[model samples]
Target: RQIRSRFIDEVDSGVVRTETGATITQKADRFSLDESSSPKKSTSATSIEYDWETPVSGKTYKSASGSTIEYDLQDGDDPFQVGVIVEHAKFGPGKIISRTGLGMDAKVVVFFKSRGQKKLMLKAAPLQVIG
Candidate 1:
């Protein structure tokens, strides 16, 4: 969707062309929600902070954006612990719901946003730790 929005922006600015070399007419690219249009946005007076606890790994994570994600991935031996987000070529993106084993023999049960929960081998699973 983000790529599609950028393509529309390019098309609106007359930077995109069709296969037949046809160019679109340029016009205003301003949106009602853009910073140039709506300069002031409402916000809460009190800052609210939250935390998430992983069901499988029994770990709690804090995210400023309200999403539980860990960034210190360089210090961990087991990267597939609960609350870790991972991306797979086939499974897309998901959170690790459960995991077992160790090293190359490890397995994780990830709950993919689009594909739902799936168990995959840590090795040869086309997985990348992305939390």
Candidate 2:
């Protein structure tokens, strides 16, 4: 109160500002922020979705974010049996230990070098024979 009357009121007579006990008001009807305003979020991966291409080995697809996401597709040739070595698109190298079912329902247990061991479907599991 004392500072406003002594300091502010002395130098505040140009635009004519009114000060009341409850309020000190100034008119700003000419204020505009349209030129400085913009969207909070810019064009991003989530806002502008990426249409991924069909994943295949030796082929690469770039995302909207500019990074190439590696899509390990499930593709392989069946030469599966016990003691057969194979390379998976995702799990790296593994050896076939056992199998179950046949053809489309075929599933095999494989011991992976990095992922320990897991069972994979023959028709769906992405594998390539290395050995």
TM-scores across all candidates?
0.41, 0.40
Off by over 4 Å in 1: 1-76
Q: How far is candidate 2 from the true structure (C-alpha RMSD, Å)?
A: 22.7
| Top model number, TM-score | 1
lDDT per residue, candidate 1, 9-117, as tens digits? 4544334434333333444664222233222322223543222121224334443335443333233556778899999877799998988865445788999989998
Q: Positional deviation of 113 in candidate 2, in angstroms?
A: 1.5
Tens-digit lDDT track for model 2 on 1-131? Answer: 23234344344333442221122333333221232322332223256522323323444545344545343444553367678999988899999999886444468999998999999876567676799
lDDT for each candidate structure:
0.58, 0.58
lDDT of 2: 0.58
On the 0 to 100 scale, the lDDT of residue 48 in model 1 is 35
Clashes within 3 Å, all models in order: 0, 0
- 10 residues in a row with least lDDT, candidate 2: 17-26
